[model samples]
Target: MKRTTLSIALLSTVMLLTGCGEESNQTSNTATTQSVEKEPAQKACYDVGETTSFERKDVTGPRCQWRSEHNFIVYSEDLSKPEYPGTLPVKPGYAVRRAKEWPREDLSDASSYDKPRIQFWWNNVSSRDPLVNDYENGYKIWSVKIDGTDLRLVTDDMPSTASPQTFMMSRSPNNRYVAYAYSYGEPLIKAIFDLKTQQTIQLGSARTKPYLVWADDSSYIYFSDGFKRYKYTLATGIKEEVDVPLSENTVIVDGKLINAAGLGVGVYDAKTLKRLYTILPEKEFEDSVDIEKRIYRQIAISPNGKYVWGINSYRKVLINVEDKTWLAFSKEGDEKKVYDKVVNISNNGRETQVGAAIITIKHYGSDYRYELTGKGRQSWKVIQSGQNTITPVLYNADANDGRFLEIENDE
Candidate 1:
């Protein structure tokens, strides 16, 4: 019973993990590479100075700093507000580079926790191609806190030919390590970066870019090279083969298996394998439109298995497993179907409050915010009266925190 890596096309459907920046004072540092077998050839490394900080004193546009007493729903714009001078700051670099179609940022893994950090690929060169520029060479991984204070170089040994869009990363719950993978030209390669030591441990290559998932305690990491699954122990440096069948587009919580495929998703009891709820996307496009455009991807289930969220060809979405209601962010749609109208919703049946959620909304030509506690849609609570919408390129979900990272809608 070998656990095979599920071929989840969530990222493929939507182009994920692209980065852009102007030019900054690039410092060169040698990266310490540790390989399981023969060590990789030593190469020049890149480093960000300890003095480099994007902290802004007067953040009049939008707020990017975390609020200790804020609502559950945290937006990327809000998180980047305190640090970023503008929506796309190209002066000091490290800000998202946008294209004419969409704001092009390294939509990789952006943290949502208290000390959230974001990781991305940067080449010290200032050129914006659709993917990685051909002339670029200094490909490296860099990370910084949301407030842009602690900037550190994760690794500078990324293959020059590696596609930036193919880059995928996940930070461990403990924030000690970052597991990342990307394709150089053909087959994919994966590795773990030590945040504390500022070094890298290169795992073997994978046929496909394997997904990185860390254990709750951050004891072990799970990934597949498209054929065999592996569990790498952080302390012992032991990589063991494992047989755990998992669907990339699904999650199991409280004995419930939630799977999102094609145009719909289903929730089933893991033991009985019986479906409990079937959620489908709203009918937004005309019937003559291609059905593939309506397919759902990046599906996520809440820790309690009560709710699910994802994105499709058009917009981000959400669903209540119990009610089987699929919600979409829309300008003109049904009151129940429009997630824009959803003030807040959270359910904790056993405890006094299981969870709480809020959505920044637009009502009657004004801004509003609300938090729902599973009792029903509550009254509009204006925690922040006027909020600006910044285009979000990446989202990282911290299941333990009961909240996911978000960016305001560009619309």
Candidate 2:
């Protein structure tokens, strides 16, 4: 009886060991399945037959779409080469622009002494009606030598009737040419002035302001004609419509023209005009109590193309480019603070001096006061300031100088 009992116990132990081996095998097979599922799929460089659209990697849905029918062609920056084929010849002296009446000594004191000079009709003094009165009193475009030696009036004919409306000035990306836009009357005119030959080609009648952008110095010129964006070749006289509407306040970077569009921001191939991706606005802030209560006034793109500075009716916000994160500038009494407006981002973006005037607000009361307060940098020194019924109370502040450019009525 004892022998039979011992044999039964041994058989039971063998069965238990066999069951444990099967369980171990099942766990190993389950782990292998999970490891295969966790691996990410490889992505292709280029997708075939893909429609041009902007897709924010952080957001869902087709946020923005571009039609090829709208004279939109996408150029790959990789494929687009410089216009001037050979090595660019170095010029000895720098280019400069100054007023003819201004002394060469005074020109040296101007802030833009180092930059190549191009002339614009500007008032000698900051006034309430600088544009209206100054241009009518015989102000014309001028060019100044870089060394502050020569100053010559570019346009011989000064308008006797109305002020010449100067819109914008830009040097070509390749530094081959200089372009400016001016409005004579109803129709706007753009002139591409060739510095090499000292000749000007008047490209007439644009719907809105003509934005002259360059892919390179000698090869191509990009402009938006209100309806569409066009690239004109100086050598071949070939003008082609691109595949997407170029965004406002766009800059060429990494072979792509990134634009600030209505929906969000988009990146397009500067050569092929193909839309790469659209960065969508953060949705979390859409439902915020503060943002919803106040009206958003202006948005400024940083010079370095890293952050976006936006001013609302109530407050200011800074947005990060890479992470789609935002921080709002808040002011309470004499103390100023910056808080995270959007989630998932640390409040670490720094403020810099913005060149252009983004927006202006007016307050009319006994408590009316303009105060410039930020963490690190102060306001820019005011170039000019004045107050009138027509003009908003001008309080110009410069980042370099800590003084206010305050204008009080002599009346």
Candidate 3:
């Protein structure tokens, strides 16, 4: 059955390929005339330069060269951290607690691994935008070891052209390949850099702005070209358009594509191109308040893909995919029903706790500060709070089961 399915897919791909050239140029010229103009084949990767060696002292910033033998995890410290210049640090098991200072200059980008030592990328300077000037004076790639030793630069030579705007880079799941996008105004180009061979291949001109999400190590790469979701096979060089149109943020789970698009979230089958299920947004909550006046933003997805975590109307919510149930944490009501800004649920969904920050409200020319009652043996506590941002980092199984851990302020 798998072989038969494969045969049908191949046949369908051939038909699509026959019309791609005409389809790509439909706006520029008529289909008949455009048929003669062929679209270039996708290259396997993109090349910037050869890998060379450089010491940390040679770069402008303090300790500018770094590389990691293991896959490294990249995260941003500030939520408002700009699109670039955010440092990707190797998640060391032991925490390095020090006075707040600039991140290492040499390690700019990094990948995540499960165990042992992970790898990270560094910039020569502490600027938020590292690659903005890489093409001007040339940029270097460095490798850092797990123990924070053997930091060295490795890149052949820099490109002649200025670094393209919106240069985004991500390592493949297997850590064998690094993919990046070179934004050229309207049309964006994607390229994959082979870490083992030190070579690059351009994926060809993207139809729309391309954002990449990898499926796995071997078969296919999932990338969205604005409106449509496509899977480009590295082995066959074939691109297949899926039925589902993906949003900017997409999550791959159990070989499925899950994304929030238009009224609900969709679970799509990557192989067969079918939507298995859709979880519509809860209208009850939206109708309770004027949704038009609120701003909704998605933050993170759980590793298991069972919950969708997001902030709506400055309040955090956890939406369960299985039941389509909405759990909200807010600071506006009674103890039994109302909550502040922080809420946590156990993995089994059995235990839950809600935390909130105390806020002062001025009404009728009077300043009123609301606080939680039933402090000793009952529910909820003010874990963390401030004027700007309130973050409840941890919650216990019961009201008094565990104390609110900490509240982080984002000012």
Candidate number of the best lDDT: 1
| Candidate 2 segments exceeding 4 Å error | 1-98, 101-168, 174-176, 216-218, 287-296, 313-315, 322-325, 331-411
> Please, what are the lDDT tens digits per residue for candidate 1 over residues 1-411?
223323345444334432112112121111223223485642311112211234422222222232222111112232234332222221121222111221122323343334334454554333332222433334555554332323344555566566543324666656677777767767677888776576688876867546665665667777777788787888999999875443444445556666655666777765566778677764546475577767654554433456555556666566667677654554343433333322112222111111111122211111111222222221221112111111111112333242222222211
- Per-residue lDDT of model 3, residues 225-302, tens digit only: 556666777778788876555543455657777775334467878667588888655455576767653435434333
Which RMSD does model 2 reach against the true structure?
A: 29.2
Candidate 1: what lDDT?
0.44
Task: Output the worst ten-in-a-row residue range by lDDT, candidate 2.
Answer: 387-396
Candidate 2, backbone clash total = 27
Models sorted by TM-score, best on top: 2, 1, 3
Q: Lowest summed lDDT over 10 consecutive residues: which window, candidate 3?
A: 359-368
What's the lDDT for all of these models? 0.44, 0.41, 0.40
Residue-level error in angstroms, candidate 3, position 345: 15
Cand. 1 TM to true fold: 0.45
The TM-score that candidate 3 achieves is 0.45
At residue 132, candidate 2 shows an lDDT of 31
